[model samples]
Structures are given as C-alpha cells and as structure tokens.
Target: RRQFLITRIYAPKAWWFGFCSSVYSIAGLWAGAALAIYAAMIEHKNVAVF
Candidate 1:
C-alpha cells in the first residue's frame, strides 16, 4: 500500500514534467524567432540612417 501510494504520487509528477518540457521548447522557439527579428530590424535601421 505504501509503494502504491508513492507510485501514484510520482505518476502525476512525471506527466507534469512532460507537459512542462513541451511548453519550454515552444517558448524557446519563440524567443529565438523574436531575437532574429530584432536583429534584422536593427540592421535595417542602421542602413536607413546611414
């Protein structure tokens, strides 16, 4: 009974980790895209000012 309860508790934690991993990956992708766009905008602005 003790082992069963421990397993049940960890099962949800395992699922939570999986869900968090996907969310983290998606956020990382968006951050990368935003950085790229910002860099392009800076380059364009410099060109226009020069």
Candidate 2:
C-alpha cells in the first residue's frame, strides 16, 4: 500500500533512534564523569577541580 511508504515508515523513527543513541551516549558519559569528579573531589577530597 502507498500508505506504507518506506521513507515514511523509517525516517522519523530512524532520526529519533539516532538522536537518542548518540546524544544519550555522550550525555551519559558526561554525567558519569561528573559523578566521579564529585566523588573524588568533594566526597573523598582527593584533589581540587575548581
């Protein structure tokens, strides 16, 4: 059926998948790094970051 156009079937979902996969990858990395820095610099007082 024309209603099942391939582009329409995959385009938006693919874009969302790409954004979620890539952006979440970096966001999660930074969030984890920040948590580690907080634990080391503030919680454990190992060194200075600010």
**Which numbered prediction scores highest in lDDT against the true structure?**
1
lDDT value, candidate 2, whole model: 0.76
Alpha-carbon runs more than 4 Å astray in model 2: 1-10, 43-50
Tens-digit per-residue lDDT, 1-50, candidate 2: 67547755768787678778999999999999998868875765554544
- Write the residue-wise lDDT of candidate 1 on 1-50 in tens digits: 99867866879887678789999999999999997788787987665433
CA RMSD of each candidate after superposition = 6.9, 5.7
lDDT of each: 0.81, 0.76
Query: Evaluated with TM-score, which candidate comes out highest?
Result: 1
Candidate 2's TM-score: 0.55
Clashing pairs in 2: none
